[model samples]
Target: MALYKTIGAFLLFLGTVSGYANPGACSGTCVNTHDPSIIRRSDGTYFRFSTGGKIAVHTAPDITGPWTYKGAALPAGSSIDLGGNQDLWAPEVALVGNTYYLYYSVSKFGVQDSAIGVATSSSLDVGTWKDLGSTGIRSSSGKPYNAIDPNLINADGTYYITFGSFWKDIHQVAMKNPPKAVASGSSAVQVAFDPVKTDEEGAFVFKHGSYYYLFFSKGKCCGYDTSRPAAGEEYKILVCRSTSATGGYKDKSGKACTNGGGTVVLESHGNVYGPGGQGVYDDPVHGPVSIRSRKTIWLIMLIIFALQILYYHYVNTKIGFADGQKQFGWNTINFSSGWPVV
Candidate 1:
């Protein structure tokens, strides 16, 4: 009987350590963590980048972390100045061979003068990031037409980038190295899509199970008032899938993405408003998963829950002993009864 109890206790401890759902499964207060780029390191840690232009890391022995933030990967002074008030936004990160590349947009809202820049970091941790400078792939007028928001992917040893906001349409350019943008003369194909709203942006591409998934966000971002409906608005993450890398993109309803085809993957459920700017991470343990933030009370609740679970397990393991204990009389408990008191 002693050996049996010991084995059962060991199994319970393992369950507490290993069992968890994907972080992306979180609903409710999950808000506007837009334009997210995710990567799983060789050591099983998952790092993410977003429009904040500051990269964040989430380390878990597993994919579902009570994910703790380890400070900004890009320091406060690392951003490039594109004149007045134009800050960094919509960061896209990709890993090729031994190097990691970060592409981001530098612009202010409603401004045509914006440019995209690239930064490189071998480690995702804080202060290890280095800016590689602008891609030089400016707009047709040589000005920033919000030309900075970039999504990068590697296919068969070639690097391809897709970018652009609601100027005309999204544009795709091929790259040979980290900061070198595909030359203007190279065949840059416009992703066939018409914007329903000028605030539409945050484009990402991923190849999964023979289908290439193109994800984008539509509606206003970062604007508290100008962007409408508050939390549960029309601004949400949408997806289109194609068999080819750059063609045949269509919504689940069979509408062509070239003609505004999109299907919502993540949207506001209640107070969680306008969750856009998303990137997919192929997690080591949970497979492909997404990490986005929300603006609401619910996210606070989620954070509290996550923190509580982590603290209880890693910091307060003694408290967990009472969980499996059986309650006897009023205000009394007994672990000797074992679990599921039959």
Candidate 2:
């Protein structure tokens, strides 16, 4: 049974990502964001948060939106001594157990000194957030990993955070509920590393079917000055999956993610350059949506709606319901062979 399930999952993964087009990109109000993260509210408002002063906020009624700047998640900056610039980066938001957890990075540029902090809000609105201080995850000189670019995921029954950039690439640690702190005595584990062993960040993980997929960006992430980027330095997204959420992730070619293996999910295409710093939201209307920020923010909304419909059609037809009617029921009336049943 397990083997059959695994085979089914592999087939689904292959079929879904095959010839995938670039997710629809949106500009105007959604552009120019640094490390943007998006989440849909209960009321259907799509809120986007990004790296900037007080963690900038934007909102729109739909996914492809004329995103209007609403406010900042943390207006006063972090309580920690973040090396004086008082700016935040990589805002990752998730609603877990009746509270909205907004995690942001507080650090000085190009330095190993950094901390991933958390803010709590019952209502995901600006100024309603109360600082919960740091998550006790930090990095400094001589450490293998730099603690930045935090992404929170609630997998199975446990909450885990995947973070870090450059250096040793991305790492993950278990979190306690309310998501304010790492669980006591839980050692951080390195999950995904860049093949060149540099510049991997914005790691997000989610489970689909029987596998847990890890998505991360690699290459030169912030070089907006296109005139001077090194060869293969353009940031791109890649993914790998494992049955367990903790580790042992592998790409489509069956290479382990720990060995710097990943299937390229998205990269530079058209006007979208250096697309990275992504987060995924399971929208009620569209299922699971993967959101990433680039030279422009690509929302990738509603496209999954069509996929969902097609998946239903695929499953239904696979079970011999090709005509949208089961073979066992009276509704399976033959119309082509004779008169339709009343």
Candidate 3:
């Protein structure tokens, strides 16, 4: 899941973006998004929390959508008793101040008996979320990190949370109580690792200009109905960079994402197969400004925060997830070679 924060007038507009052209191919309900997490409420709507029925909820005034099915942000699921708990995994929404939390991810797929929960909302609608189960951020089985793919970020003013998967992959912590669990006596700091296939997980971090990019997801995500991991080796999308949002990440040859480096920003091209669950933000605009219409590139998502999008999830070897569906993609970044490509 990917939460976002970096808006002080967009921090010099998230530094750089140019020639945008394609964040296209989006339509109603945006197709079965898993691990998705989007936010945009101050009255323009746009919700969209993802990963299965318990945390589903979708809405959209524009982000290039017609998205409307707003239903479960825990409609009676996840009291945190664990074991699938009505199916939830990676939601991660954020709006810290007028309250909107929504963290999520209990666990059941390779079993670490994980945790990581939270739910709140002042008005995201869909019955106004409020689960509040656990945010202790747990994991088992020799835990080195495997709570699940969460990703909250605020940096400079603190608030971090970069979860994990695949044991010993990505970790980070420093969100206390009202900030939402895992802080008292802190202990999570890995930040990004692969050490030759510890097989990363969806980790997103973004501060833009002074660095802190990070963006994970690597190797075998999902079963593909039994076997399928060796043509670019399943899931893709990788990145690294850091000036210290908790660790010293690196890439672009400086190499040090915990010694496994990282660089490919989206992989398995052509009809987009296995393209990681990435993220980035900057979509604000409150009034008048237009983009000259290709039917209004959906008004560049509201046209202001640069809409530097990086949304992800792919697989369409003719409708993949082994035909169970897992789509919902995007791209509008171009950070001018300082990294981010799409």
Top candidate on lDDT is 3
Instruction: Sort by lDDT, best first.
Output: 3, 2, 1
Mind giving the per-residue lDDT tens digits that candidate 3 earns over 106-176?
A: 89888888888888888878887878787788888887888877888888677878889877789988887
Reference-based lDDT, residue 275, model 3: 73
Give the whole-model CA lDDT for all candidates, comma-separated.
0.53, 0.66, 0.75
lDDT of 2 by residue, 96-176 (tens): 878888998888778998888999998788889998778999888988888888888778678899998888888999988
Error of 3 at 237 (Å): 14
Question: Top model by TM-score, which number?
Answer: 2
The reply for model 3, stretches above 4 Å from the true place, is 1-47, 50-56, 64-69, 73-89, 92-104, 107-112, 115-139, 150-167, 171-191, 194-238, 241-250, 260-332
Residue pairs clashing, model 2 = none
- lDDT for each residue of candidate 1 in 249-278, tens digit (9 for 90 to 100): 788788887677777655543223444556
Q: Is candidate 1 or candidate 3 better by lDDT?
A: 3
Instruction: Give per-model CA RMSD.
Output: 14.8, 13.9, 19.5
Count clashes in each candidate, considering only residues at least 3 apart in sequence or on different chains. Answer: 13, 0, 0
Better of 1 and 3 by TM-score: 1
